[model samples]
Target: MTGMRILAVAGGYPGWRAQALRALAAGWPPDAVTWTESDALPASAAGQMTLDYAPAPPAQTCAVAEPAAPVPAAPVRISRDFAALLQHAALYRSTQRWALLYRALWRWQNGDRSVASAADHDGARLHAMAKAVRRARHDMIAYVRFQQRAGGGMPEYLAWYEPGHDVLASAAEHFARRMGKSSWWIGTPHGSALWDGQAMHLSGLPADPAAMPATADQVEPLWLAYYQSIFNPARLNEAALVQHMPVRFWKGLPEGPLIPAMIAQARAGARRVGQAAAVGEMPGKPVPMEAGRAQPPRALPSTLDQCRRCELWRHATQAVPGCGPQGARIMLVGEQPGDQEDLAGQPFIGPAGQVLDDALRRAELARETVYLTNAVKHFKWVARGKRRMHKTPGQREVEACAAWLEEEIARVKPRVIVALGATALRAVLRRAAALQDHLDAPVLRGDALVMATYHPSYALRVQGVRTPAQVAAHIAETLARARQLAEATLPA
Candidate 1:
C-alpha cells in the first residue's frame, strides 16, 4: 500500500481514530492519502490504486500490523479540551473531514500545542463546526414532537425528524431520561433510535407511516389552539421569531401551517386587538366544582409555627399568630395576615393596622385591652408583575386553619367577639353567616357574644353601600357597641 492509498472509514471519530493510528504507525503523512466516507467514492483523484489497511476495532488505539519484525506501539498524548472538540467536529458532515482531523492530530502529536487553538486557521473552522453541531443538538431536543403510537406496540410513542447533523444517538438520551420506562421511537433519514424501556438501539430503519398519526392524541389540537390564541399581533416580531425557530423546522410542527396565515392577517389588521378574538371566547376547560381532596397524612404539626395543614405555609414568610394579653375581655377577629403582617409574625401591622388604630381611637377603646387575631394564620397571595398581590383564601384553606382560631378563642375567653368580616363570621360560628344581614345584631357562639361588621381594611377601598370615611365611622361605632357589651356582660 504505497502510492495514493485510499482510506475507507465506517463513520466519524472511533472508526477513523483506529485506522489513523495504524496509518501513523506505518509512517503515513496527512497529505499522503485521500480520506473518504465508506459510502462515497471520489473519481477525480489519480492513484496507483493502492488500498489502506482493513477496518480497525472500536477502541481508540492503533491495530498492530503482523509484520515479520513487529514494532512496539507508542502512546500519543492530547489535552482533554482538544479531545472534546474533535468528538464534536466528527458530527459535522464533510468530504474532507477525516483528512482535516488527521492533520490536526499529527501536528499536535509533534508538539504544536497551538494547532488546537482558535488563532490557527484550522482551529477556527473546527470551532465553528462544533458550534453548529451544538446548535443542531439543541434544535432536535426542542423541536421533536412525539405522537402516541396508533396501536400501542412495544414503543408507546413515535416521532419523525430531520436533523442536519448526525446527532440522533446523542439527542435520543434526553428523551430517554425524560420519558422514563415509556418506550419511544425517533426515526430520521440518516438513522433511527428505538428505546425499548431498558436500553436504546440504533439502526437504519425508516419510520412507519401507519404507526404515526398527523395529530398525536388530543393534545396537539389543544396545543395549537393555545399557541394561536396567545400570539399577540401587537407583540409579534417576525424577524426575531424566525431567527430563533428557523423556517426549515416549521414544516414538521402542528401549528406550522397557521403561522403564515397569522402573519398575513397581522399585516392586514395593522397589529390591532381586532385580528384575534378575546381568549374568553375560545373554548377552555371548566373549573372543577367542589373538587374533593385527600386528607393530609397527619394532622397539623405540633406547633402553629410549623403547621403544614395547607400549602399556604409554603410561600408565606412566616405564620402571623394572635397577639395580645392572654385573657383580654374583647377579641377582634379579622380575615388573615397581609404582606407586612406576614413578615413581622405579629397581627395588625400593615395598611389594615392603621385603619384599626383610627377606629380604636374614635371608639374611645384602648388597643392593648382587645385581643387581635385572624381566621387564617398565613398570608395568601398571587404574584402580579414584581409584587405579591393579596388573594382570598379558599373554603378548604379556611377549614384547615380552623383549629388555630379555636385554640386562640379558648385561650382568650373573651366576653365579646367582634367578627370583622364574613371570613371571621364563618370561622367563628362554623357556618355560612352573612355579614351584611347580621350587622346590627349579636349572635351567641359557645360562651361569647359574636358581633359582625366591615373589616378594617374595607376602609381602604370604595364600597357600593358606603364611602371609605363612612366605612371607618361605622367600624368605630361597631367597636364601641362591642366594648359596652363586654363591660356589661362579664363572667364572675
Candidate 2:
C-alpha cells in the first residue's frame, strides 16, 4: 500500500504548535512526505490536499478554504484539565462559537469521522465538556487553600488560589488591593502572582506546603460546633451543599471537619423546630384570636418614647413611636429605623422616609393624614467602627416586638394599611409572599386593604443600578396604584 500522505497543520507559532503537529505526526508514517510552510509538492498531489492561508490583514479574521482531500480525523483525549480549558474558552465566546470550538476539538481527537460528526454525539459531547469544565473550575476555586507567608510586611495575611480562567483575576486583584495593605500572593497552577502594597510580582506555582496559623488558637472546632448547632436539617440540599461548599472548600473551612456532623445536627435542629411548633413553643408562632376582638397589648404605655423589649433599643439612638390622628384613613408600615430615624426617634425623618415622602407627594397622598410607624419598634444594626449599619430583623426579632405593633394598630385603627416589604407584610398580613410579585397587589386583612410595595430603601438602591429609571418609574407606578386602590376601597 502506498504510504498514506499526511500533512501537519497549525494556527501559528513553533513551540506552541509543536504538540498538535507531533500528535498528528504520530498517527502517520514519518516518510509519508513531510511538508513545511514553504515546501511545495507536485501539482496533482498539492491539489488533493489544501491548506488555506489568507493574507494577514490589519484587522483580525480567520477564513477557511475548501480542501480537495478528506481530512483524516486526529485522535485526542478529553482529560479533566481540557474540560476546564473548554469552559474558560466558552466565557470569551458565544454559545454557538463555543459549540463550534468543542466540535472542532472533539472531531480532531476522535479518529472516527462518522462518530465525531454525528449531530447527537457532537452536541452531547460539547454540553458535557462545557459542564464538566464549569464544575471543575468552580470546585478548584471554592476549595483551594492559601498560606500566610513570612517576609511579606504590612499585609496582615496572605493566601494563594489558582483560577481556571483569567475572568476572576481582575476581581481577585481588586479584592487583594482593597482588603490587604500588606503583601499577598495568589498562586494559580499556570503561574503565581503577588501583590505588595505598591507593586505586583509574578512567579511559578509554589510548592505545596502545609500551612497553619502560628498561634495555638485554632477556632475551627468552636466554629464547627456553632455551625453544626445552627444547621437546619430541613434545608439540607446535598446537591446544593456540594455545589456551594464543594469538598475542595472543606480544607480551608475552619469547621470543615464538622460538615457531616453539622448536617446531621441541622436535621435534628429542624426536627426540634418542628416539634416546638407542634407543641406551641416555637418563636414567632401566630397567636390565635377570636374574630372582631382587637388583640391589644395587655399593658399599654402612656408614651412609646421608651420601650426596651429587645437589644435593638440599646443601639437604635431612640424609639420612633406611631404618629398621626387616632382614626386616620391610612396606616403606612415601614421596615425599621434608619440612622437618622434612630437618632430622631421618628419614622419618616431619614433619607429613606424622604424618598417615601416624595413618592407619596407624587401620588397625591397627604403624608400628615397617614399614620406612620415601623413593624419593628426597635432598631437592629451592626456598628461599623463608628457608623451603625441597619440590619434586617429576623422573624423572632419582629415577633418579639409584635406587642408594640399590635398596640399601634389597635390605637390607630386605619382603614387601609400598606405593607412595605417582607418585614412589614409579615407584620400586617401574618404571611409573606415574594415582594416583587405582590408589589401592587392588595392583600385583604379583614375589611382593610393591605398593599405591598418595595421599600423606599429598595427603590433608592435600585436607582443606582442599570434599570434606575425603570425602577424609579415602578416605584411611582406602584405607589400610585396603592393610592388608587386605597381610594377605591375607602367608602366615600
- The 0-to-1 C-alpha lDDT of every candidate, in the order given, reads 0.82, 0.58
Candidate 2 lDDT over residue span 1-492, tens digit each: 222332332321232134333423333322232333323334564444433222222211212222233444543565565444444444332224322443445345654444332255554555555555566555555455444545434344555454444333433455565656666556555455566667766553342433313223233334443464355565578789887776765755566777877667656665565455446634675667875565445554455643544566555555777788788767888888777766555687777887788878887788887898888887788879998888999887787678788777877776678877679888887656677666766766776777777677876676344464565556566667766665675644
The best candidate in terms of TM-score: 1
Which pairs of residues have clashing backbones in candidate 1? none
Question: How close to the true structure is residue 443 of candidate 2, measured as C-alpha lDDT?
Answer: 65
Q: Kindly give the stretch of ten consecutive residues in candidate 2 with the minimal lDDT sum.
A: 56-65
Q: Could you give candidate 1's per-residue lDDT for residues 78-162 as a string of tens digits?
A: 8999999988988887777788888888778767788799989888888888899999999999999888877567788888899
In candidate 2, position 287 carries an lDDT of 69
Clashes of 2: 8
- Top-lDDT candidate index: 1
